[model samples]
Target: MYYGWNIVGVGMVFQAISFGFTIYIFTFWAEAWMTEFNVGRTQITATFMIFNVAMGLVSPIAGRILDAFSIRVLIISGATCLTVGFLLISFANAMWQIITVYATLISVGSVLAGPLAAQTLAAKWFSARRGLAIGWGSTGTSIGGLLMPPFAIYLLLNLGWRQAHQVIAFLIVLIIVPLVWKIIRNTPQEKGVEPEAPARFEPTQESGGQAVQWTTIKVLRSRNFWIPIIAFLPALAAFSTVQANLSLITADIGISQQKTALLMSIIAGSMIVGKLFFGGMADRWDQRLLYWIAASIMGFGILLLMSQPNYTLMVFISVLLGLAAGGFLPLLGAIVGGRFGPEAFGQVFGLLGPFLTLSAFAPMLGGWLRDTTGSYDSIFQIILVALIPAMVSMAFMKRQAPATQASG
Candidate 1:
């Protein structure tokens, strides 16, 4: 078997630990923080905003480091930061300490070890199979989501939140640090293997024969760079809004806490299916069409939420949202790789990081809308309207040429 598959496997594990701890298990931790700190919902939401903003600010630097440095070094450093940050969080006595840690260490760690790194690794190792490779790797996030919450809840119940953080920190040391150190290589060439697609040795005008190095100014000036970002922003924002507020949203509709937890698992489970299915399709299908399909599903899902459906109907709605959310990361990675090419993949992806800060506001906005209007209906409506321009922008995006296709 090719070592690239090993890279993908390690990437999957990296995503599982990074996203499981940072994203999936966040709401559970937030609940504990609220009780421990005696804070309001909005205050809890602010920490999440801080986490994202910090990640956004650091992403470009992380991306450049991924491009220029060893993947092993970056990932191991991130794991150490996460282990230390979580351990510190367990000892935090005030909300300020939690905010500071989240904004600094956790935020930086997540960028280095999370989706951006995993996707960039896949991009480096596979060209023709980039979508499928990324699809498989990105599944770590959904898998983490499916497994971590129940485990964390159990820890939070039996041991206490502090001990739970300690256990998670220990697991990172045992798992992520060793796996990345042993298996990850900066590129396929490092393993004495060729990438899945034909290697480009001749310089093109766009990229000078070496790895395409995109300057910040060049990336910012390109319309191709911004099109996918604009097209997917709304869907990402909606997913963030739902993930951050799902607990509160379900409680408002009279769903039990247990059922809300199950809904999160359902979303995660369905995301696995979405990532694999849409990921395979991206290599064969028009990516813009896939975006349209995802956007439509997202719109319908939000409409279902507006109705405040019962738990039974909410299960179905969760599948719709999960499938759409699942497709977002892999598709975006494939699109970025397709447009920018593997040579410049890291810088381009990193450059795109700041745009993520826009989605960071979705959670805060959702919370504010709920507090002001006494319901989440207005936010759902706003998200639905936001999808219109995304879909339209996707329509205008130029299709990838045969040579530049991910399959190529």
Candidate 2:
């Protein structure tokens, strides 16, 4: 029995809550806030952009900071922020106030408490089984996303958005904080255990099959470094834009909000399958190839998701998208951890924040296209166009060579 599994359980629970409250839950309120504030669609979209920007700016720094201390401290602190942020937003009367809370506290706090931490925790504790560990851990996001929305929507209906925010905040403080304190330890050595495979040095060739140390500077300079970043950017952009607006999109197309909410859950439920399936399989399969194939499938899903997808058709598309998104976290985590080792994972992953957050603007773009063209058809077309190069970028990514191998 390993203590790391306990950490993963805590991470799964907390990350699920984090993703649920931070971004997915917010979608339910977008229209409510817009109507209350008397703002337009673009204005509503900007808040999410601010959230992404804030997470982008803060995550890398938070990652570095997490590397310096015990994870429990960060999770507790993050839970506090989330609680207080929700408390404050409950009383907010203006759009700017809501945006400020989301950007400054909720988004940053989410990075501290969510999948980033879970992934890092998994990376730290496991080496040979890193992908599977992270995959199970990353399921929190999808599970949270799956379970939270319908419940949140119910809350939104019965409790009202303001009170709903308060309830959400209180739940985070009550549920997540104690769990973090009880289960999470920074490394396995705290419990007198060691990582399964500290380093894999069997390969002489520079393929992605080793655990080698990498500095942030060296990583930024490598072609392989940008592979995941550039390769996945479009998918992430599409994901960011679609998830944030899926509720509104469904409403626009004459679907019931209840049904639309179910669609959100369907996407999330499918993600659990993808993450779990890919996570376990990554150990035995080529994670890189799996990701490339998944990304291609997601592109096709986006093509099928137009302004007026039939509910039946929408359900199928959601599954494809969910599986794609689900597979991404573990594959990316495994690839990075597999190539770079865990020592610099926090720092290396932090550097990815800016590029990753860059897609946050995709929602903003969708808003702009909506306002201009009166529909999301153009945005979907733009996403399809962008996926072309995203897939192409993976071709140039090479496995990193260890320092001694390079010197020889």
Candidate 3:
């Protein structure tokens, strides 16, 4: 067993905690916040926009730091911010305080500790099995999604939302800080092992050599960079819209809170299968084809949602949605890693962050549309239409090529 697997395990745990406690469990908390603050759904959803925008704004800097500095130090700093931010949120007396904490510490911390860091680490450690490695590591988010919402609801029911935040903070301190310090290494060379590829180890301009460091301007100008960003944006926007509003959507349709949580877990459970399946296949299949499949499934799921199906039908829809959602992260990681090489992985991924902030608005839009139309149907229809361009643009995404070397 290679030491890189250990790094993957740590990343899995990191994503589970970061995404589970914050993104997956947020809607549950949103319900409580609405009652406590006397605010509307759109206002609560704005926290997600602020959090996402903050993460996007900080990602490029974080990416450069990851490439040039120590990942262990960066992760530890992020853990500190995440723990402290959650602790502060427990004491927030006003909506502005929650917004401020989310926009600053929480958002910044998530970028440092979340998928960007985890996928970069995986990309660095494995060459041949990059997709599988990323898929396995990214499963932590689905696992977190599967488990966190129910646990959060239990805590929300028993301890109140404030105490729940405190518990989440404690878990972060107990789990992420020590594991990252003890287990994570920057690359395979640091652990005295070769990357999982043929043993030739000969340096080349294309294979296992010093990768060309892409400048920010060059990365932005490349069609390779922009194509994936454009291809995946709508799917991501739709997923974010659904996750952020799942609770309210269920309530609007008169589903019980318990069942709603179960639905969320079902979506997450299905995602685990999707991630493993799509991830393992990415190494062998055309990545663009896999993405189109996932996008199509997602579109069909959204179409089902517009029909206002019964609970049984909704369960079926959740499975479709989960499978599609599950495929996105691993594919994105694999695509970026494949195209850019590990040396430029962090920087390229970081530069791509702000564009993802666009997805954050999907939730706000969902909330506004629901509030204005008194139905979620319009948002679902809009998301379904959004998928058309995503799939079509994906057709134009060229296959991966050797990373271009930077000029002196």
Q: Model 3, 1-408: lDDT tens per residue?
A: 878889999999999999888887787788789989888866787787788889999999999999888898898888889999999999988888999999999988898899899998998898778889999999998888877877998999999999999999999989998899999889988877877772112112455545455788878877779888888888998887887788788888889978987888889999998898888888879889999999999998888888878899989989999999999988998888777778888998998898877888888788888889999888888878877877888787767654434455
Clashes of 2: 0
Whole-model Cα lDDT of every candidate shown, in order? 0.85, 0.81, 0.85
TM-score computed on alpha carbons, candidate 3: 0.92
Worst 10 residues of 1 by lDDT: 199-208
Error of 3 at 176 (Å): 1.1
lDDT tens readout by residue for model 2, 185-256: 888887677657543432223354444446567778866668889888888888877887787688777889
Error of 2 at 260 (Å): 1.8
- Of models 2 and 3, which has the larger lDDT? 3
* Each candidate's clash count: 1, 0, 0
Candidate 2 Cα errors over 4 Å, as ranges? 198-213, 251-253, 306-308, 400-408
Q: Which rank order by lDDT, best down to worst? A: 3, 1, 2
Please give the lDDT score at residue 395 for candidate 1: 76
